[model samples]
Target: MSEKRALPWLDSPPDGFLEREQRIKSQKQVNIDVYGILRTKDVPQISFEVVGSTGNIYRTIIGNVPFCDCPDVRFRKVQCKHMCFVLSAMDVPSELRYQRSFLPSELREMLATLSLKRKLDTTTPTTAGEKKPVDGECPICFNDFKPKQKTTWCQDCGSNFHQGCFEKWRAAIQTSDNAVRCLYCKLPWKGDEPETPRPTPKAVEPEQRRSKMKYPNVGDN
Candidate 1:
């Protein structure tokens, strides 16, 4: 939802703006590029690398105006898809909606609160579905999991994959209408929870997996 209050350098979009933004999002016309988010010690404005259908990275900045350096936004001077995506995802508070840009310090403060949460949650017991560590094996490759690599899991079939292997499987998928399906279940990624829990493959040495987790550089979002 676009608010009425405008930022210092931004103006309220013209009529039909929200409708147009929703249309583009529904059509999936824009792509959030790999290595898209750029934050540095140099500039205050965070840069986002967004790609259009043509796969060309567009220069977009997250500041007061949250601008896209596309000809459509440059020449036509309208709200572009890139700006819409960030604003929608960021969940800017109503009271803080008109800020020029969010500072790294602000994000660091929020992180501090999360750090406190980790300590508090240490003694708290969790359920099997939450923070349930899988085994040190890549289901896709059926190989030993490498350290400092990204991984994602299929909640439906309870299968995990190294992010690279997952991408390869997803890329090689030949499905009707090119749908995004779970590699293990061969079902659409989006679905309601099953009434009966499906049998999950046993993760080899599941409890013996290391707890010393270290995040690696995200190759893509």
Candidate 2:
């Protein structure tokens, strides 16, 4: 009977492995000297496994990342030198760090956190030179409507949405409420009012004709 054997590469990777792989693959060269760094062993020991050029197997332990120069990693997608080198440099043993897969919600939270951080970092107060008057013409109307103009602002998204566009946009969304803001641009507009019943016009009564005064003619005769 043949003995059962384990397949070499049947495990899933960590959260950022694919992105990192793509980025690493895009790079022409990685300068981390895997052998030199591994020899010192000052930092964490990162185990690397890579297939090098012409089927050469190169392995090195360095910093928190691992590097490999094998043909599998470089020419083919089986395994690459850069990934091995990065793994070795990072001192991640074969199994522990690979289990760090993030859920969808966790990934969304991470992305949101990153976006918030970026926004906060870029939130410098505007200087006097940066302040500009709102003199530009409206792109939709092809006419200048200053800031002081009595126009409804879109609350959902702060865009200079025209009133006509707002009405059309609101109608397109098909809401029968008394007032509705546009779904697309978020501009506020009044909805159709409940029509009051108008009274019908009445026919005027004909005035009674007065009899001619025959008494005046008798007095004259």
Candidate 3:
């Protein structure tokens, strides 16, 4: 069998192309906020909704035909800044970022290695006490907060909890009559009102293929 080829873009890249791509990858202005990732179980594909620096959202996909719906890729037929941002943020290897196509196994491996950085929610009201730094074990899960892990703070006590663990912990005790309370101090979470229950999603048929994961942009703790 013929050796599997990769990185077709490098065959004849423009002068300084690699350098420009590297700058894009490291530029802080290339915001990746307000994005969602879709990974399918049946198909070895990962899709991203990456928000660009100008506030425009672009679709970047990694599959047999890696693609980005952006002017640079569409018009110039080159890897665009958004594509570079996605690959770099997802920790794709420097050598593999310019690959023209990806294999099923390669896609699966990329998904397995993906590490998302959680963003902080600026809208959450600041509590009375000094905001504590993210440290120590989550009161509910008792797990140490990994760097950049999603977390929410107790408005009353200023203690922090893993976002997922806090949601589960809050749900168990929150009632219509009572407000959600801090797990550590038992003080009523000042700004955290009882959440309205969401309607259950309709069941999917067995024959219908569904995405394995949909990762939302949950900003860091």
Candidate 4:
């Protein structure tokens, strides 16, 4: 849980980074999940769109080298989470994916799986009362709770926080005895498996995705 929004890069290794940096990057990559990554439609390929941990979307472009629009990527010029996502979607083996060259792809099969599955299915939260957490608003970030985003709950106080905000709060108390206390109640909070946001009222994934995906293979283009 790190509250540092202007935070340092997690799993990103700088260009020509050393072995120690590589090891550290690999370890942190585990904590970050690739939400969704799509191959852009421009000629010779342009970039990939990735849904980030904070429930925001970012762009990852493969140029003379790999790059992401996130602050960490721009400032550090390292293989940030968004690039990790782009590489992961390409099905590049873990060892190869770290290199900038491997981030770009001509593989359509891999692209298909990620096309519309935006957002990580990390955790769904309980909102207290009868309404589902997704139905109510989050206590922090002030954004409406979305089923697609990772969410957390406090059983004691029945308050819910988005995953990013939850981790941010947890970071704030790291120096104190209560690491994961409820911000509202100061009660220690327990961790639980996260739930994905429920499908929207229409719930039309299977039919829609299949219809939209018309290309037969990478060679088709």
Candidate 5:
């Protein structure tokens, strides 16, 4: 009888595994964006369409057996940048990111967290003019603002949020009217005015210019 393959998640990762994963994450050039997320009804698996740095789209699955179709994973048999992007974007913990498998309960918790975030993203804030202290977690991502991180303040409410998080929140709640409003105060965002094309200057006719002149030039005769 053939022996069963051991689960990778059960064993400790190889030496330098974490350092290598960190290196991949720190690479800004390996840009990635999630196109969409798919969840299986019967299976505990979740799939993501991740756009990679080279503009190629790859399928990444997180569940009993984590998988990524990127060349780095298929050939090297190691975690790839696309996998790192998906996990990091979802704010998955560092300990779980390296795991090759996840329990059903873990997947459920992740999905629940994501669902709550989506709800928060789409729901407009009703409370207006209530200024939240600058030190708390951002209402959008629910993450604490780090020092030196780019940030923006609500003009009316005086609430502060990470600039990137605020932008995402603004985008999610944008209306057909093209109005950008403060997330907390629900008032029109002062500095985020929509760009309008500058009006073209009208040309003045020579006759009109001459008519308006207080004194006619002698050379005009």
Candidate 6:
């Protein structure tokens, strides 16, 4: 399973406390569910007031870019869950959905779907008989010219990396940072189907193994 990084916004305080305070002062408290939070979009602003079952209301602000009236945000300049929750509620763009809560299996499936969607979305208009090659070079290693080789290219941007190069690059990137996107480029490989995690062998039952064993059949023959 890939070790997912906590989104900066989820761990740090939101930005601009005074500005957030003004915004929160105008809005009312809202209810959010877990899944609902994931689907929300980025809005102009979001404010969270935690009354803690008690009457004491603690209010904080989160924006698309995020601003909060909390000291942590002002001093440390980081995003807090309040910001993440608000952003999720706002249905922020995928680029901004910083938190990754999906399990490895779920992430793999998501990536597979994303890969397919990318392919379909990027398919150029062409006749059935004609296969046209889009031209582009790798921005990282610059192994651009593989004139005679049939290579798998990125469906989103027509960037082509040699299959061998891609494999080597991915292997080298396996340990740089836990689940950090490859330093060579922004491409993420940590989520690749985790090598079927090697199974731990259990102790064999002696009686069952002895009973099931097959002896030479020469005597019966």
The candidate maximizing lDDT is 3
Q: What 10-residue stretch in candidate 6 is worst by lDDT? A: 212-221
Candidate number with greatest TM-score: 5
Model 3 over residues 5-25: C-alpha lDDT tens digits? Answer: 454445454555687577663
- Candidate 6 residues lying further than 4 Å off, grouped into runs, are 1-136, 177-221
TM-score of each candidate? 0.37, 0.19, 0.47, 0.31, 0.49, 0.23
Query: Candidate 2 lDDT, tens digit per residue, 1-221?
Result: 43222223337764555565454444322221112312232233334332222212244332223233343434654444355334323333555233323233322343344234324312444432232233443322323455656344333343343454333333322212234553223245322333344333234211111113211110111
Which portions of model 4 show Cα errors greater than 4 Å?
Answer: 1-46, 62-64, 103-221
TM-score head-to-head 1 vs 5, winner: 5
- Count of backbone collisions within predicted model 3: 4
Better of 4 and 6 by TM-score: 4
- The order of the candidates by TM-score, greatest first, is 5, 3, 1, 4, 6, 2
Let me know the TM-score candidate 4 reaches against the reference structure.
Answer: 0.31
Q: What does candidate 6's lDDT look like per residue over 81-142, in tens digits?
A: 44443443343444544442332333334334423432542355543333236354332222
Model 1: CA > 4 A from native: 1-13, 29-43, 93-221
Q: What digit string (tens of lDDT, one per residue) describes model 4 on residues 80-101?
A: 7656645554444555456555
Residue 50 displacement (Å), model 3:
1.2
| lDDT by residue (tens digit), candidate 1, 31-84 | 222223344553234454443433334556765345777766778876676655
lDDT of 5 by residue, 125-158 (tens): 4244444455755554445667888777765666
Q: Between the candidate structures 1 and 2, which one is better when assessed by TM-score?
A: 1
Candidate 5 RMSD computed on C-alpha atoms after optimal superposition onto the true structure: 16.1
